[model samples]
Target: MAPTPFESLDDYISLPRIEALALSPDGTQAVLTVAVLKKDATAYERSLWTVPSDGSGAPRRLTRSAKGEAGAAFTARGDILFVSARPDADGEADDESGQLWLLPAGGGEARAVTRLAGGASQIAAVAEAADRLVIGAELLPGADSLEADAKLRALRKEKKVSAILHDAYPVRFWDHDLGPAEPHLLAIDLDTLEDTVAAVVAESDALATAAAAADTETDGATDAPADAGTPYPVTLPRPRDLTPAAHRTVDPDQVAVSPDGATVVASLQISEQRGGRFALVSIDVDSGERTTLFDEGDVDHEAPAMSHDGTRIAYLRSPRSTPEGPADVEVWTAGIDGSSPRRLAAGWDRWPTSLTFDRDDGALIATADSDGRGPVYRIPLDGSAPLQLTSDDFTYTHVAVDRFTGDLVALRSSWIAPPHPVRIGRDGAVAPLASPAPLPAAPATIGEVEATAEDGAPVRAWLLLPEGASDAAPAPLLLWIHGGPLSSWNAWSWRWNPLLAVARGYAVLLPDPALSTGYGLEFIARGWNSWGGKPYTDLMAITDAAVARPDIDETRTAAMGGSFGGYMANWVAGHTDRFRAIVTHASLWALDQFAGTTDSSVYWQRIFTPEAMTEHSPHRFVRDIRTPLLVIHGDRDYRVPIGESLRLWSELAEHHAAADGSTVHRFLYYPDENHWVLKPQHAVVWYQTVFAFLDEQLHGGEWHRPELLG
Candidate 1:
């Protein structure tokens, strides 16, 4: 028999990933984004794909291109409103201007609504009454000439600084220069496509106040320059001296405007300890009244959906986990007047991935993981019994409800199936809208493995034997650690396939230590402070047990992970040189340096006490590391920060040079990506680089691309 043809990485990675499903105003139609894969560079094409709520018509593709399209919605008359960034546009930012497009809901060509450009993103269709859209828009400098003089004055003030001695440490008493600050805000007319100065949120006022203090400190006395930008009108005037902590830029995906346009509901956290909070604020869209409906404090509340009658709101809330353990999450409802807030359901592991309310009776409909299988669920507004709409064992990550018919549109995938959008039949049957793509290459053998933690706690894990391997001989192994420590590799996921390593003749081992979720609250909660302790020991024991099998080679093993998993990769290298190659992604290298540079330094402190933190940090043990390493970071990742990766790379390189021994350590940075690599093009590049690095280290061959260096 002929051997199966060798499968390329492209084949397995080419399956489409769907995101952002929005129902039309009439609820009869829907618009969603589908990412298409290309031979060389995969493109994010968000065309308007329409599927009827009744599952009668075949899904039709409306827009098609390599550019990105997002923030889809339908007008009252069923017109599609969306923002598209077309590379085909000749303008700078490449049609990144995010021009608004209108397409007839009945099927017609999408046309530009207005010429306003320069990155107008986050488009939301207001109700039928208003001829306006709430968009996160930006204009080029030339659009507002009147503010030019104010900008110049502010720039001049910032340039004027006073340098003072004794503010520097660790170096000579070099002076520290402090400069003035300035803030700006504006509003744009959706109808006329004109720019106007809106009431300044207090973020800018703090800037002006800081500027005044700086001017006074330098000159020994004086008020801010009279030439400063004029204050907005009293009805919506710029706030004066409002604390910086009180204001924030709205999340593109999280903010919502009320039905009457008199309020803005936002999910926020003032500090690390405060956890997640939601504020249902009454704001005059025109006058910006800014009255708080309620400040629901010290719990996670997000993805709020207002009822049709506007008498109450529904939201998901989760208590923040403390260092001691994990916390349970629940669904909740509250009266608009801030009274009678009550829990509708409890024991939910996570939030409703997405939620929508039925207009006619205000029934609550949401897409969530219920009973270990992610599915769509429907519950009435009065807190009635929840009906599980889709009960397939396969995981459904997202769901959208039709506004008119209450039919559901959702994404479905399982351990063996790549993701595809599905339409739910009224009778509860499910069918895929697109043809199933080719399945990813499978491991030669799939097996479930179990191990006992140090305390005799049972741990579950999965092992994938390399394809075409013989039991008589040992094969190289790769151990993969998942991030989140809180997050577990679900039993039903295509990500478990070991095709990449299998093609290269290596078995893969994925072990879940004491901290992984999905088993129970107690099991997952154990990870809060188990870092470098029992959890790490469990991983080591699991590896040791797995390698004892006749088909595994212990010496040629490598390890890789991102985020918390990245931290483990570095930790393992420092603790022992058991593996030849280690690859870390978005890792926290030096805990001490991380404590200062990371945005959530407070979270680290909360998770681990300062003493435990200093003792367990990988940076404290870098001198003990002997394994070759490769590190990857995205420049725009605020969570882990690029500096952490850089610090680790530099430290390892210096240690090798000092010891007069060559150790390979390379760092790669993706300039435009974020914490999660979303772009299909960049994701492929990352996988290729990682594989190339590991292959060279394991096989000892000259890599084709020598120019790709640290």
Candidate 2:
């Protein structure tokens, strides 16, 4: 029998994926970042594709390079701007840091705009009414400007120095080390490209001339090095340092420029003792002047969206979580200059994430997690209830609102579908737009299973049914939990996907228990500081409801999860011996140890007291675990460090070991991968190893190890 994509890990990894969507100024065409496996099947390369906003024509490929194109945005001139490390195909050296490139709207080849040595992270914000653009770039801590930053970087490379001196709280993020370089927002005007490059080149010429004269008189050696001169300017546009003397302050992703390009609104990461919160600020793009729009240490002001007329700003305010309870996010709108802020949709329960202004700036187009789906809502400034525009199971994101027709263009995805572009009309009608990549077909059927928790709260799950699962031949069940104790199992997941399990004739259940979002603040608060209590009970209730179906075999079951879900998996292993096997990835075994060691330690510490954390920790009842377990972790996982798994491994070997020091449990360790199996080959091996383990426990084998494991 020929295997489908879900049945074959290699085929599944080669599937094309759409990453993001960006609409043009007139909303005539939308640019999409599509990724597909490269020739060698080792890495994924991204290219830009354009789809019609009116759903009238087929999607056209816009840009392509092996270096990968991303962060697609449109300038006021309708030119498509993206970030890519792709060198000039006309014969230029490859760039390690991605440079900002622009494809002319009229019709021409793409051109590099700002040539920085460190490469631009992404296009932060593009002005709607002007030729100005703000980009997220990195500047060395000691350097005063980006030019100096480039020279310093060149000098460091020359000296072969890779060490970073840190005096801050977080020296590293999830997978990579935090800097010697500070992230900065740079504002560049497209019209002044030639003049600014000329000015910079002239300055370099004068400095070189001065150095030459001095060298002639001295030992023929001065400070201006050769590599420094290399990055100066073959042809580069200068960028205004909108943020100066920044120390990991600016939140790179949450930034926006007003339509006129005169003002920029951004989220600033304010670091505290153990962790940090974000604050919103407005800046003068040209003058580099900044004003404090909102900054409270106890609360986070994030996702700032500018009004089209460039006057008002809409943002979300989230009070810090405490041991008492988790806080609900409140959507607020205020003047661009920080005046008269008011909350929109006063009693709206959904957690709105990304926000944008409507066509006329009278209402905010916001995407919020709602009952297992992320839907776009039109929130009126009059404080009326939000109107959900798209009524579908697919989660919508990166919504682009039409300034003329008041239509919305966004990318929506679900468990059954990859991200696909859709055009939403003014009358709340959704039209599927042309996509460069077709959605992959799922091998199993998706159905809903819900139950009432012991506390009378509703718990829900997505059940994947195999083709032959019936009362005559019941299929074994796999209860898969979602991470983020604060997240919902609503969207399509490249990792932790259940289609592979269903393809193997095992029914899979994806449950969103207590502490999951979209159910409102009260629902999340139910499991607050009590990870083992409400969340665990909620999961069991939903799993019980799923197993009650005649097609599912409750006796042959396994549990799996990662991160917060991993914590629950460990808790479940200790609390019950019902499951035949359990798989926990990057799990937190000891709550006390995790609270102090995790990347965002401050936030978790505040949410759970020491005693409360210890009381609910999974490690406390390790001896009670009887189910055969497969522990998975990546050494570089700082979010839930490898130490959690290391300690758990030691305890399992100590207690569950036989007289010959052999145990039924297994440990799948990734020395190079991070919290997630991001690399294509690694992801293939991940699913392979997982399936092998499940086959051993569920079908009774001598542990059929995956081929690549050796």
Best by TM-score: 2
**Least accurate 10 contiguous residues by lDDT in model 1:** 168-177
Best by lDDT: 2
**Candidate 1 residues 436-553, lDDT tens each?**
2333435456666677777777776667776555667678888888787666554343233455666667887877776665565666666656577766777888888888887888
For all candidates in order, the CA lDDT equals 0.60, 0.86
Where model 2 places Cα greater than 4 Å from the true spot, the runs are 1-3, 89-94, 195-231
Name the TM-score of candidate 2. Answer: 0.96
TM-score each candidate: 0.74, 0.96
Backbone clashes in candidate 1 total: 1
Task: Give per-residue lDDT, candidate 1, residue 113.
Answer: 49
lDDT (tens digit, per residue) of candidate 2 on 510-567:
9899999888889999999999999999989998898899999988999999999899
